[model samples]
Every structure is written in C-alpha cells, then in structure tokens.
Target: MEKFDNVVLNSRAKYGQFYTDPNVGRLLVSRIETAAPNSVIDLGAGLGSLSMAASKKWKSASIVSVELDNLSYFSSLKGNHFHIYADALDYDLPNKIKNEYGEFDVALCNPPYTRPLWKPEYEKILEEAGLSETRGVPKDGRAELLFLAQNLRLTKNGGELGVIVPSGIITGERSLDIRKKLLDNYCVGSVVDLPRGVFSNTEAKAHILFLKKSSPYKKNIKLYEVKKEGGV
Candidate 1:
C-alpha cells in the first residue's frame, strides 16, 4: 500500500483497509457462480483481493470495485475490474450502477469494523463512510449498519451480498436494528465464522454473512456454517 493510501480516514486506513486473506477471498469469489455470471460490486475494496478473485472465477463477471486509498486504487487497476476512487458513503452509487453493463448482481464488502474516533456516534461514522446523511451525528449507529444499508442499495433484485463484519456486531445490542434490517431486506444465506487471528494487524473475529435479496422471485433461506482454524 502506498504511503498516501495508508493515510488514515477517521483514524483507520483510508478505504477501510483490511486486505482479505487469500483463501477467504478465493472462497468468497468461488461462491459467486460463473455459469450465469452476475455483476459484482466490491466496497472498501482494499487491494482488490476479492475483485481479482471474482474475475478469475467468472471471466465475464463485470466487477465494480470501490477504493479510496491511492495504493488500493492502483491495485484495482491490475485486474479487469472497474475501479471507483471515492468514498462508499458519498459516491453516487446508483449512477455507477446505471453506467455498468448490467445491474449489480452481487455486493461484497469488508467495511471498517470500528467507528471513527473523532465522533464515536454511529451517524458520524456513516456520514464519512458515505452511506448516509449527517443528520446531526446521533450517538447511536455502528458502521456495520451503515455498510449493510449501502450494500442493500447497490445489490439488485435476486442478487447476493457477502459482507465481513465483526462477530460481536451480529449479537450486540447496538446492532439489533441492523440485524433486523438485514433480515427484512435480504435472506441470510450463511455465517462463516472467522477467528481472531484471521486479521493481519487486528484481532477481530469477523463473521462472513451471505445475503440474497428476495422479492417474489427467490424463496426460502440457505445457511452454511463454515468453520476453519487459523489462516488457510
């Protein structure tokens, strides 16, 4: 990552910097079917790990990767993915969607696990993430919720969403509304349990949540428990 890319946004690496582990990235990409091929959207796409992996799986899959950091932005250029250099919260995402060859078929993101230090409230973090408005920086709201909302907005009908969020968030009281929101909007596919050491620099037990939006087309719910030890 470049020094400028390493520049902190809200006290964390710009572009929500958590490089997805190789094995996990591969697995996540593999989850997307190449048979039908769906458009892929990657938010906070650090180094384009997942983007590149998806491209490898579905050669025809059009990937729209979002990365604000300079280094990650450059990395995205190495692949066949369309790179967007902007904040996830502030970017005109629907425009990008309209401009894409097709509607987004999958929305993938590894959002910043923690809220910004400058303003500990949820609304503040969301505003900077570009997911929502800064309607008076409420003391509530975790970045996790905002990320989910943004993901929902980008994913099309019958599309899938793969998100890596801190485990505590899934069960936390503060995340209650977010959890409900997710269930109401999309069907929970699976929860892949990741240990604390999965992160290169941090100790966060993140859970990979697979979501598929359902209208009247898709029905039922599928859940998987993929548990593995250490790094693969």
Candidate 2:
C-alpha cells in the first residue's frame, strides 16, 4: 500500500486542494462576531483546520465538516468534528441533521478554485435560495462562486458566514455579477485582504469575507487590510 502522505498528496492533486494554514483558519474564525453558536458547518473542509479552530472558539457548538477528498476526510476523522465525505455542493444533508444539530448558525469555508461549466443544478441551487437570475454572475462561473452560492443556501436566515476567497472576486470585473448577488443577499460584515504568500504554496492573494444572511438587504460594508501584525 502507498504511504499515508503519498495518498494525501495524490488526493490533493486530484481535488485541486489547497489546505488552509492553521493560523489563517484561526484568523478567519476570529472574525466571527458571535463566538458561541449552537451549530456550525464547514464546507470544503480540508484537514479540519478551520473546523478545529471553530470548535475551540465555540466551545459548545456542533461542527459538521464536509470534504470531497478521501485522504483529507480520513485525516479529519480523528478530530472533534462530524465528518462527511462527499461533495459539499451535492451532499444530501439530511433534515435530521438540521433538526438535531440546529439550523446552521454559522458557516466557514475555503472553497476550491475551479472553472466548472455552468449546469442546470446551478440554477436549482439559486432558485432554492430564493434568488432570481441576476446580472454579474456569468454562465461559466467559477466553482468557488458556486460553492459560495450553495453555502448561502445552507445557511439559515440571520446566520453568519466566514469564507476565504480569491481577491479577484472583489476587484475583478468578471466577478461583478456574483459580488452584486452577494451584497444583495447578505449583509456584508467585513472584508479582510490578506498579504501575499500567506498560503505558502500559492501566490494568489486572498480575502476573508465575513457576511450575515439578511432579509430586505442592508447597506454599508466594512473593509479592512491585514498586515504582518494581523490587525485590520
């Protein structure tokens, strides 16, 4: 049999995985205004770094981590979390989980960056979320956007979300539609731009998006920049 690390490396390549640094995960969790929640969900959870951080922070919260990569999912099994090995986008989150675990009070995600072709499922996802067809989200939207949309669907009204996304989604013209959709649906709590090389492996600059699901929309979004000291 192959070595454990070899299996993980292979899975990483197969899944386009980029595991979040523990420090980065902690930083993202720290952005949550409410430290204590009854239930939490971590989508595209890799190695359970963010999930672990959240468990520590929440103390009494039940965390469900959904991952697609087998090796990574297996690694998280030893942690204090409920692990689900499946594509979070397509996972059948049972109603029992929702009832027992409490309708997800918060969600944290560091979604994969892939350019998946648009599908009818994407439309179903949006329709389920009560979001109509909106401008800015292109037909050939990236997978990260799809993941974000799905996360929104999973989150309950008034729930909070902390996600790490590529900086382009905030600044790039191509992402304007999605951004518009996001601002329309969620109350923007804050956006923290991380320094380059934070990921160690990738050069892409990342932003931590802190948002809250709101009805009727809200104005004014907080923006911050994280420097070496980790302050906004």
Candidate 3:
C-alpha cells in the first residue's frame, strides 16, 4: 500500500481517490445490517480498504472490487475476490455485472467526488438506470451522486449499501434534490458524521451513509458522530 501512497496523493483531486481508513471501513461495514451476505461489491474500490474490511467480517462471501486505477494493488489481493479494471460509471456496467455476478447482496463504495460538467450522456445513463427522477443531480455533475446511483442500481432489491460521501451531499443546498430522492426512494438506515481530517490530505467533511435498496422509505433514520480515535 505504501508503494501507491504517492500515486493516490497526486491523483486525489483528479480521481477523488481518498483511501478509507481501516477503522472507518470496519465502522461502515458494522452499520450494514445484513447477516451473512452471499456477495459483496465495492465500486471505485481504491486500494480495496472497504472491501478488505467487508472480507474480514464476512469470511464466506465472495468479494468483488471494481477500480479504474491502481490495478497492481488489486492484483495482489488474495482470497475469494474478483478485481475488475473498469470505470464504475460505464453505462453498460450494470448489465455486464448482472450477467456475470448477478445483483450483489451488499454494496460498498467511497466514490470519486470530482464535479465534472453534466452532459446528455450522463442524463441518459441515469435515465436508463431508472434514476431519471432522482433529485439533486447538479447541472455541473457530481461524481459522488452518479456513483451512488450506480451502486443502488447494482445492488439487489433488498441489498444493503454502505458508502462514504462528502457532507455537502447530506446538507448542502445544491444536494437537496438528491437527499430528497434518497428519503423518498430508499430505506436510509443511518448517517454517521465522521471526524474532520479523516482523509490524509483533505479536511473536507464526510459521512458514512447506509441505505437499504427498498421502497416506501423507512423514517427516523439513525444519526451518529464519531471521534477520530474511536468508533461510533
């Protein structure tokens, strides 16, 4: 992992590739309520920290990691895991994975946060994925939301998702629409406000958002706050 530390730091802004702390990964996985999921997937799995944590917790599960860079690190991972080198946002990904692995029982991600300009192609992708009505899709696209949507699409109907996202997606005005979509369309399990400086280079606030891929949104979602030194 040290060999790619410099690479991760250099490409942080470009790829939104902040690696997850192992403790945080464990915390996120702990929040997921699934008992013995058959399969687990981590999209945009930089260095596979989150996937690794899931693997530790669910020893019998098959782990799947999709990453666009740092292929060598994934190549070195052992155990019942399949690592794929592909863009998580590719529109055909859902179909391809469905044919190969079917919908996953658990999905985890710490997706890229870079905001690229919105394009018709992106709109088309979301529309085709049945997320056309999803709120808070910015005119200048947010990579996090796009990745979140894709994760949701990839998860089975009753699957659980644990994701790390910027706090802006939780409270910022620009993200209001997406927040509404989550509340209306999914069972939001909880949101944990992580301590500042969780990432090595960025002080940007972030949260662990847990959701179940079901409708008739469950209310009174739990909220938590964690100190840098401890778990929630």
Candidate 4:
C-alpha cells in the first residue's frame, strides 16, 4: 500500500486521489446496517481498500471496484473482485453498471476531495436524482457530492451506502440543500466524525455517511465521534 501511495503522491493533486486507510475502511464497512448484502461496489476505489474491507465482512458477497488511475486499477485487479478501469464520474457509468451487475446491494466510496470545474453532465445527474433544484448544486463541481449521488443511483431501493466525505458536506451552509435532499429522499442512518490525519496525505476533516436507499422516514440518525483510528 505504501508503494502504491508513493507512486501516486506526485499526481495526487492532479487526480485528487487520496487512498483511504484500511482500518478506516473497515470502520466504514462495519457501520453499514445491512444484514446480508449480496453485491457490493466501490466507486473511486483506490487500491481497493474499501472494497477489500467489504470482502472481509461479507465473504459471500460479489465485489465490483472502479478506479481511474492506471496503476491503481491494475493493482486492484489482484483482488478476486470485478474491476472497472474508468473515470467514476463518467456520465454513462451508471447505465453500464446496471447492464453489467444490476443495482448493487451496497455501495462504498472514499471519493476525491477536489473542486473540479463544473461540467454540463453533472446537471443531468442532479436532475435525475431530483437534486438539481437544490441550492447545494455548486457552479464549480463538488466531487464528493457527485460521488454520493452516483452511489445512490447505483444502489437498490432497499440497499445501503457507506461513504467517506469531507466534513463540509455535513455542516457547511452551502451544503444545507444537499443535507435536505438526503433527508427528504433517503434514509440517513448515521454520521461518524473522524479526527484529522486519518488519511495518510491530507488533514481534511472527514465523516463516514451511512444511508439506506429508501424514502425519508421519521427516525433518529445516530452520530459518532472517533478521536483516533480504530476507535469505531
């Protein structure tokens, strides 16, 4: 893993590819509420850490992993999971996955944290998800939110999602509409606050968001704070 990280370090800013810690990946997988999901996916899977963790937890489940980096994608192929070598934000990817694997039972991701130049395709995605009207729609794209929307689109009606996103999406005023969209359209299960430096290369505060792909319901969403790695 260290070797992989070193190889990508020089281009991390260009690709916005920061890998997730294995322990943190395990923690995110553990928080998913599903009892027995048969299919799992990791979009933006960097070296397959999150998908690898899912494989450990759900031994019988089939795993699908997608990565954009050439080296990372090839490295992930070492696992027994199906691997896709393409940009996760490609507009047609959801349909491709649907045709190939159908809607997944679970989706996990630790997406890139860069603010990319906005693309017209993103508007189409937000419209499809009924999030186009939200104030949280950024003129300059937010990669994490786009990844969240893609995860939702790829999941089954009663499926689960476990994703790591920047804390801004949880508390920023600009993200209010994104929060509202989640609360209004899905079953948010919990938000786990991870301490700084959880990722090897960045200090951006991050949170693990747990959601179920169903209409909003009246329930108390749990909140957890982890001061260090492995605390969850």
Candidate 5:
C-alpha cells in the first residue's frame, strides 16, 4: 500500500508531493513562535507534519488541522492529531475555533503550488462563480491565496498568522496582484524566503509569511530569499 494509506488517507491521484519535512516544519513553527494557539488551524494538513510539530511546541494551543484528500484524514498518522477532512474553501471560520483545542489564537497553512489540475476544476466553475471566483476564495482555490484570506477571517483582530506560500506571491507580476489583495486586508509582518532545497523534489519555490490580521507592523518587514535552507 502507499504511504498515506498506511498512515493517513489516500485518493490514489496525487495533488502534489511536497510535504514540509520535520526540519522545515520546525523552522516554520519556530519563526511563527507557535507560542500558544488560542486556536490554530492548518490547511493542506498532510500526515499531521506541521500540526504534530505545533502540538509539541505549543502545548496550550488548540489546533484544528484540515485536509481535503481522502488519504490524509484516514491516515494512520491520524492519532494524537485533530484532523478535519473538509474542502478548505467551504469550511467555516470562527473567531474562536474549537477542536481538541478549546479555542484558537492563530491559523496557518503550507498551501498547494498551482498545477495543471487547477484548470479543469476551475474553468467550468468560473462561468458561474462570482466575487469569490474572481478574487480567489481562500478555502476554494490554490491553497495560497485562499488560505491567507481564510486565516484573516479565522484570526482574531491583532492575532497572528504564519503561512507558507509561493515566493511569487511577493515577486511575480501576477502574484503581486495577490500580494496587493493580501496587503489590503492584513499586515505582512515578516517574510522568510524558504530555501529551494526545502522543496527540491518539487518544481515550485516557497515563502514563509508572518502576518498580523489587523494592520502592518511598525518595523520594516523582514525578507529572505531562502534558496535551500528549509531542510526536508
């Protein structure tokens, strides 16, 4: 059997195989402080990698991790981890998210890198989808933008958000459009360029975002072009 079937749940068709390894997970958790989740939600939660790490680091934080694939929620890695098997776009976002966690203080995700798969799911939907379709729905679209918006809604004012997304979200021209949208609603507190090797086997580059929901921080936002520093 495949690794996910043996551990979590599997759909047979792979969306993408870039799971942030333990080391990188630690790095992300560390940067975000993973201090205490009044409640923490993870999108694209595969095998509980980041959720597991966050649990170990923030014993007091409530963590609600969600993954849509059949393989993840049913994985053997399911235990000791609170996994919600739901499509991110459709899931509810509450100010006080409760799970094994009594409440949540933060939310985050390592979203999907766009692939050819998106066209089929979206091209047809686009004809009828309204503002959400044009603007990109956090729970529905490629994990990055949707997750950002989702986090903003789920987080309390002044609460913290840390997510891993594509560096292009900040650098690419098209992605800059997404960046503009993010800036409109939330504050970009910090940016960590995940090293390329962190996603070596994969084709896309990633970035770590430390965001504050209410507004931008007073200090200059930190930026790093992490080329291969996130050890998977």
Candidate 6:
C-alpha cells in the first residue's frame, strides 16, 4: 500500500477520498443487523476496509467493492473481496449484476463529499439510473447527496444501506430537498453522529446513516449523537 501520507497528500484530498478507520468500519458494520445478506457492495470502497470487514462478518456473502482509483483498487486486490475499477456515480453495477448477483442486499459506503465540477452528463447519468430527474440543481450541488441517491437506487427494495456523510447534509438548508427525497423513498433507520477525528486526516464532522428501502415511507427517523467520552 502507498504511504498514508502520500495517499493523502497526493491525490485523495483532491478526489475527496478519505479511508474509513477500521474501528469505525466495524461500528458501521455492526449497525447492519441483517442475518446474512446474499450480496453486498461497498461504494467508493477505499482500500476495501469496509468490504474486508464485511467479508469477515458475512463469510458466505458475495462482496463487491467498487473503487475509482487504480492504486486503491489494486491494493484491494490483495483482499478476498471482489474489486471493480469504476465510478459508482456513473457505473450502473446493480443493473449489470441483476442477472447473476441480483439486487444488492446491502450497500456500505463512505462517499466522496467534495463538490467536483459536475457536467450536464452527470444529471443524465442520475436520470438514467432512476436516482433523479433532469431538473434545476440545488443551490449547493453536493456530490455526497448524489452518491447517497445513487446507492439508494442500487439497493434492492427492502435491502439496507449505511453511508458516512457530512453532518451538513442533516442540518444545512441546502440539503432540505435531499433529505426530503430520502424520506420519500427509504425508511430512515438511524443517524449516528461520529466524533471529529474518525477519518484520521480530515476535519469534516460526519454521521453514519442507516436506511432501509421501503415503499411506504415512515414518519419518524432515529437520531443518535455519540459522545467522545467513550471514544469513537
């Protein structure tokens, strides 16, 4: 594996790539109470930490880790999890794997949060994948929101998903529509806010969202504020 410092200093920051801590990965995994998911996907599976952890827990499950970076994807090759070199946003893996793997039983992700310059094609991709339609974008075009939408679209009806996202998505006015969209589709399970330093080199405050795909959306969503007293 490349030096952590080098990975952070060279490409990750620009790409908004922050690898999940092993302990944090396990914590997120524990939130998934499903007995045995037949198929699992780790979107933006940086270094495959989450995927590796999931593979260990669900020994009989089929795990697929999708990472865009070649270096990270190559490093993941050492693990037992299957790694795919492609963008989770544009690459429609769920549709492709429908015949063999069927819909994903679970999707675990720590999606990129940076607002990259999105082209018109991105909206087209989202529309094609049933994530969103071609409409006026939000005031703050958050890539993280799009990532969440894409993952929700990929997951099977009744499957679960857990994703780490910035706290702003929960509180910010810009995220109101995004939150509404989520409320419309999934049964919001739990949102556990993590401590400041969970992602090692990044300073962004994050929260892990646990959601289940349900047709009739529930009126209530659970919120958890984890204190640093116990150490995240």
Candidate 6 per-residue C-alpha lDDT over 40-135 given as tens digits, one digit per residue, 9 for 90 to 100: 888888867788778878888888887777778434333446777887776455677567667788999988776656756567555643446423
TM-score of 2: 0.84
- Regions of candidate 5 where Cα sits further than 4 Å from its true position: 1-14, 73-80, 91-103, 115-141, 225-232
Give me the runs in candidate 4 sitting further than 4 Å from their true place.
1-12, 73-80
* Per-model root-mean-square deviation over C-alphas: 6.3, 6.0, 4.8, 4.7, 7.3, 5.1
For residues 95-208, write the lDDT of model 3, one tens digit per residue.
888877889999999887776567666776666444565554556666777788888888999899999988877767766767776787788888999997777566667898
TM-score of every candidate: 0.75, 0.84, 0.88, 0.89, 0.72, 0.83
Cα lDDT, all candidates: 0.62, 0.73, 0.79, 0.80, 0.59, 0.73
149: Cα error in model 6, Å: 1.8
Tell me, by TM-score, which candidate is best: 4
Tens digits of per-residue lDDT for model 4 on 121-144? 987777776567677455776777
* Candidate 2 residue 86 C-alpha distance from true site, Å: 0.9
Clashes of 6: 0
In model 3, where do residues sit more than 4 Å from their true spots?
Answer: 1-13, 117-119, 128-136
User: Model 3, 109: alpha-carbon shift in Å?
Assistant: 0.5
**Ordering by TM-score:** 4, 3, 2, 6, 1, 5
* True-structure lDDT of candidate 2: 0.73
Question: Given candidate 3, what's the lDDT at residue 115?
Answer: 64
Q: Lowest lDDT 10-mer window, candidate 3?
A: 1-10
Candidate 1 overall Cα lDDT vs. reference? 0.62
Model 2 lDDT tens row, 144-199: 67677777777788989898888877777756766777776668878998887666
Clash count list over all predictions:
5, 2, 4, 0, 26, 0
Clash number for candidate 3: 4
Give the per-residue lDDT digits (tens) of candidate 1, residues 1-232: 1211232333355334657786777777666542445578888887776787777777776788876676764453334578878767543555556765466788878776544333333354344323344332245444555666667667677778888877754555644655655565456766767655655665556778777766423354444445565332
